[model samples]
Target: MTHNLQNDLLVRAAFSRPTERPPVWMMRQAGRFMKEYWDIKNRYSFLEMCKTPEIAADVTMLPVDLLGIDAAILFSDILVTAEAMGGQLSFEQGVGPQFANPVRSRSDAEALQTDVVHKLQYVAEAIKVVKHRLQGSIPLIGFAGAPFTVLSYLVEGGSSKDFKRTKLLLHNEPELAHLILQKIADVTVDYLNMQISAGVDALQLFDSWALALAWDDYEAFAHRYNAYIFSKIDRGGVPVISFCKGSSVFAPLMATAKPDVVSVDWNADLRHVKDGLPEGIAVQGNLDPFVLYADKKVIKAKILQLFERMRGTDGFIFNLGHGIMPDIPFDNVRYAIDIVKEFRY
Candidate 1:
């Protein structure tokens, strides 16, 4: 499954293999902070950018060319899988994603289409374009929303602070919740396999909202399905990363899913979490995204501090604990990457 990549630091680190230094990249590396991203974003709606291969490739390449990041994630949204499963999806400028037909009942859950791979052909095509353009310079990551996270969106109909509707479904009717979760899991397995077949070098499962659940609920609703996906996909030696907003607390639970890498949040000490994981499991992130908004000296010091803590550790990747905020100064983002690239073990 190896490709002739000029910069294989990311892939190497993902496997918990020793490297000269930890490879660096940011979550949301190709998004709104860059004026170049806005130029393309202005030309098309967000979904349009995702659906169009050329435009998606254009966005996906920005970080690689501008910041010299070690990896490039495909330009797409997690909810696209839900949309393919019969959820009517849309995005308002600032309101984020909304689902017109939220699934609330057994009939609504049954209506979601599990045969979604062909419907998401645009994503696979975008991956092909991105791969051709990369020419094996760096790895391109393909991803899907973990089943519980997608189910929350479908049940809540959009973003929610309390996830009231979603939790109610879990409590009042556990059977329906599992029904919907299984459907999303089915689509996720097929969707991720489709990405693998399209030539992505690695895969990530984003359980972005996992923080919203308690231990028992998380284990029953989120962790099991995530493990199911890891078990079923034909990864073909392509490393998989399991990321969640609550990984600082859930790192142990997340590791049980058997991802090569577990991407954690800023709340925990990165080195401590790494030390607690099983042997050969790599770690990515825990830096506060706001560090990029600090002065150059502050940013440099913070980056150095994390690296120093992880000084002797193997299988570390430098990244923000979460996605970069849209308004973060682009110059500061570039400076942070420069600092990481210049550092060594």
Candidate 2:
């Protein structure tokens, strides 16, 4: 059903080029909402599904077929990178991602490799399969956890509200920690490069837990390392968007890495963010995911409100501040997208 290969919404919406309605893709756009995903997932454990290129590719295209989003994100867990590294990984119900062997010293850092493309062939294959099936309908985005964030999983081993173990690793073992970050950054760049090579049209580095740190800690442990990865591309040609979900303090500064854009979570004010950032770089998101809980009128009003803030901004990509939560009524997601498509801006 998908026809032309060259023209796609994400490529244009990401830059807010004037030819179309603003582009819209949710953060976890290829997630739980679809029955097909659930049906496939019901047949296998999450990790198994991820390792199966056929399954992963099918799920990646679910949002494209169901929600009509502008782009498709490869369907895989962010923590998969940790598993690809020297660490062991598993996902527990309600508990989130867990790692068995966390990086603690320089020795631990030395254990990782930048050859994840070779190591994680399934992920690459998944992208290839998804791209072929997409028939040029939309761009596919490939992503991994940012070094600091994936390392947070390595240090903490799983979901942590405070990220205490990660901070301790940074605070108590600063120099060794830098080595770990450097290693993770190296591998992340490789992993993302693999995705790009596999035909990903764009990439997003998700550091969803960054909000847990204060500015100084974020600067020391996070911002610089991420910059290092984004800086190294041959001509730095790929369109990369960095989204540090919690670090509202450093969200604006994230653009310094020269990513094509930066995505903000719901915590920050779009007006303040839009003004704080200089032009040329595109901006995506910062809308509260829970706002979808509101009924039609409120959703419409707030959606328009967001459009107003983004008015005149040439490269804004509309997205949720975070991901759509579990059991989010189908209508809410559709209404939000309709608002985005209907907006004159």
Every model: Cα RMSD to truth:
0.7, 2.5
Overall local distance difference test of candidate 1:
0.93
Which regions of candidate 1 fall more than 4 Å away from where they truly are? none
- Candidate number with greatest TM-score: 1
Per-residue CA lDDT of model 1 for 228-326, tens digit only, reads 999999977799999999999899999999999999899999999999999999999978999889999999999999999999888999989999999
TM-score of each: 0.99, 0.93
Residue pairs in candidate 2 whose N, alpha carbon or C atoms collide under 3 angstroms: 211-246, 211-247, 287-321
For residue 90, what is the lDDT in candidate 1? 92
Model 2 alpha-carbon drift over 4 Å, by segment: 1-7, 234-237
Give lDDT per model, in order: 0.93, 0.78
